[model samples]
Target: MSALPGLDDCVHCGLCLPVCPTYAIDRRESQNPRGRIAALRAIEEGRSAPTPGLLRGLDDCLVCRACESACPSGISMEGLMMEHRSRTSDARSDGRTVAERWFLRAVVSSPGVLDRFLGVARLGRSLLPAALLPDTPGPSRLRPARAASPPAATSRLSTETKGRAVLLRGCIADRVQDRETRLAARLLSHFGFEVSISAPGCCGALQRHSGLVDLARELSLERARDLLSGEPDAIVVDSAGCGSALHEPLSDAPELHAVAERGTDTPSLLATIGLPPPPHPIPGPVVFAPPCHQSHGTRSTEATRSLLEHITEGEVVLLPGEEQCCGAAGTYFLRRPAKSRQLGERAKERWERGGRVKTLATGNPGCLLRWESLLRREPGVEVAHPVTLAARAYGLESEER
Candidate 1:
């Protein structure tokens, strides 16, 4: 039995338990960070193969990385999880479904195919079963065709300009959250920076989390080649999950390492450029739900919070348990419906208890879709990306151009 790298870093500390969403909800040993590591260690020691129970324990994890943020030993929980998943054959079967695999391979990799499939889904939604369709608003409501155009570049600087940035329009994000991408581009333009939307492709984050490391590597290299072709000051990501994935160092692809080093999230990018005063005051209270990837993965909680508070009309109220996963840890809700619902409902209840808010802003697309699905019954509440709200406040036009 060979020892796994980073497996011994855990000192059996229980500090990660309280912050782990699965452990907090299920109170099971295998659901927490330490337990999972211990289970991996057992496998490393040749005590157990990748049994169904072991795979289930690993699959149930959200991989939110909150445990890493809370760990005193600085264990890279995210890397450990990804490494274990990649090494275990049964892990892939446990993490993703057939439909998910097909979508990731066929649709996510090709923008034209995804757009056509979304068009068909939109048209046939009424005839299809409720479970088959997206619980949040339809594609038409989320992304208008005209909204896909890049925002008019504001900077006089050429493509070689110092402040020029590229926006990663990820596969699903490109199709579902097109408005957020557009808004982010416009917001960056408003700050006097040239923004270019990257080519349509998966950031490979989903594939990596699903244990398809080879596929993830291919996608990552493809993205790196495309994005690096146009040397920009920064590569900005609107989705927190994609941003976190992009930040990961790819040893096999040294060019990808450079790209990751230059990657930045939308909130952090906006904050770094200095948020301009809102052109008009927002009418009602604004609540922020920091996505787990942003809060824990990128450690940008303060940056996102400060940006929202600075631009919102009044005090920006952070949703209680902002550190906890929203259960939408990149399709975790789809795979484990019950546990996902439990966590999402818990978050919804927290927001409900905080009174009514006109708008609820979050950093990741998964978080946005999950919150929208949970709060669909509630009227007069809007779920949006923080950059969308900032774009609105700046009076930047988001209509189809």
Candidate 2:
């Protein structure tokens, strides 16, 4: 419906060819970035509409932005797709079932509502038979919340130089993997910054990705304004996907422009600060499946790898492949379970081929959840976030006796 960034910037560059997972999957021009842009242009000019074929090319994209990074002319493939999503008909919105829409709206917009929902779900899970829970291939929607009290802080920051950092206590991580956030706070405080978990809610990355543009922008600006009052030195988001989304424009919020100017990912922040990781080794062999966002989307795997190498005993293996995606694209597993499973199996097979890796480390929460499900169902596999492993290795958490 609108003219995208002019196509002249693409230059028919073949540099992005080998890096595109869709192209690698089918070796079709239509599956690649250049062709997708062409199709978008044609659709805009009324040469064509959303055909199954044209939509396939656009939908196949993981929005990893690897092509943007690879481009000689600086094409913004991710930006283009986000725009396309806004202009496209609601009918084409992927997997936007009524239940999914309501679920996301309640959970993301209001943290209190989400917490209460979790309480109900947890109680239901306890009363219901295990068979009643959907045997989905992704992260189990039901994980028990911390019933007991949280641990007390062992130390405090100095009075003269008290600093604050707001953690994005994400919806998924807060409910399912809260321990990761706890570990993160410990690590940050160890490095001399007082950390506080941001009020529970979503950052609207999911809405943005799913073409809920107004929701995404609205929620983002609200979160930014709230966090700004805390006057944090930095907003440290541990989830790579959330962190990446925070880097983009915040719709039309003039107030948030200054605050968002300082957003930073955990790994990127660590790299900038040059924190010294302990000279210790993890107990077992570990392989990393860097989030497609960290690997291809943001290219921040170097920071992750460096941190891993610092505190591992056995060899740390980086699996060889396209590093395209794990297919747990946020709620992608729920929406496209079959395709997500295909990609997950492909990743698992590749990991096994590298000779029996005991643990798999990744940065994104979705990847952590999906991989956990894969490992739980499959015998003899362990998957966790890299930060969890790092926190343990650094002697931060007391190991269970």
Candidate 3:
């Protein structure tokens, strides 16, 4: 039997159990990191085959990597899990539906196609279920006027330019969260940074989590080439998931090392550049839900909090369960609706307990969408990226309706 790579890294210390969301939810050993690693070791040694139960154990994982943060052994849990998924072809097929596969392979991989489909989805939104439509019909102002332009070189250096960054207009972000994307660019530019918006299509984070490793690799390589073609000071990503995906180690494409090294979340980038005090500090408390990718995956929890604090004059409350997964691990909500809702409800309950807050800011698009679905009916409670709030504080009005 062949050895599973990185399986030996886990020392069975049980440190990951308490922080594991699935374990916290189910109280099952199989749902925890140590147990999952043990199971992977067993399979590698031919002690077990990939059974339905085993697959369920693996699929149920949020892959949020919170456990990795807690692990004392410094295990590369994400890499191990992805490698396992990549090796198990059957797992990929079983985890995703034909339609899901088509969407990732065809729709998401091409920005123009996805934009067209979303436009039609918007028209028929009233006819569709609440679950099918986005929390709000995206502002008409945000709809892409045309397909995203290709990744062409844009050298807009000025003596005043502090740095240069290329914005990743991800597939879903390009359509649904266009206002945030635009605001992020505006804010960066305001800070004396040259900003170039590029269509890298999708970052392949969704595909990797869905067990479509082949597609994930292909998309990663393509994005690496597109983003790294010309040297930029930073590759700015507003979505935590996209930023983390871009940061994933692409051993095959060593050329991308520089780009991956430069990849940063929007909030972190602002922190590095030094956020100027908001011209008009937004009134009332600002509650932040740090996405798992940002908090746990990238370890930018403190940096995110600092940025939020700098932008709002009111109390900046880090939501109590900031480290917990919001259950919107990319398409996890759509794939495992029951668990997703359970976790999202728990997160919302935590937010509610935090007292009256005017706005809720988070780093990931999926987290924003999930919260919007939950809070859209609540009235006056706005949810957005922290950078959006910062942009507003800097006197930039949202073009959003």
Clashes of each: 0, 3, 0
Misplaced by over 4 Å in model 2 are 6-8, 91-102, 116-141, 144-151, 155-162, 252-255, 272-280, 296-298, 377-380, 399-401
lDDT, each prediction: 0.76, 0.69, 0.75
lDDT of 3: 0.75
Candidate closer to the true structure by TM-score (higher is better), 1 or 2 = 1
Query: Could you estimate the TM-score for every candidate?
Result: 0.90, 0.85, 0.90
Can you tell me which runs of candidate 3 are displaced by over 4 Å? 91-97, 129-146, 149-159, 398-401
Give the C-alpha lDDT of model 2: 0.69
Give the per-residue lDDT of model 3 (tens digit) for 192-242. 777777763887888887667777877877787777666678988878887
Comparison by TM-score, 2 against 3, better one? 3
lDDT string, candidate 2, 1-401, tens digits: 44677554667868888777667666889978889888888888888978978986786776766677677888878678777876773666454444456676776567667777777777776677655653242325445444333334644333333367777766666676677767777766666666776765677877777667788788777777766767888887777777777767656576456555677655556566565646455766788888876765556788888777777886888876636666678666665555566777776677768776778888777777667766675667778777777777767766311
Alpha-carbon runs more than 4 Å astray in model 1: 90-99, 126-137, 141-150, 153-162, 398-401
Which one wins on lDDT? 1
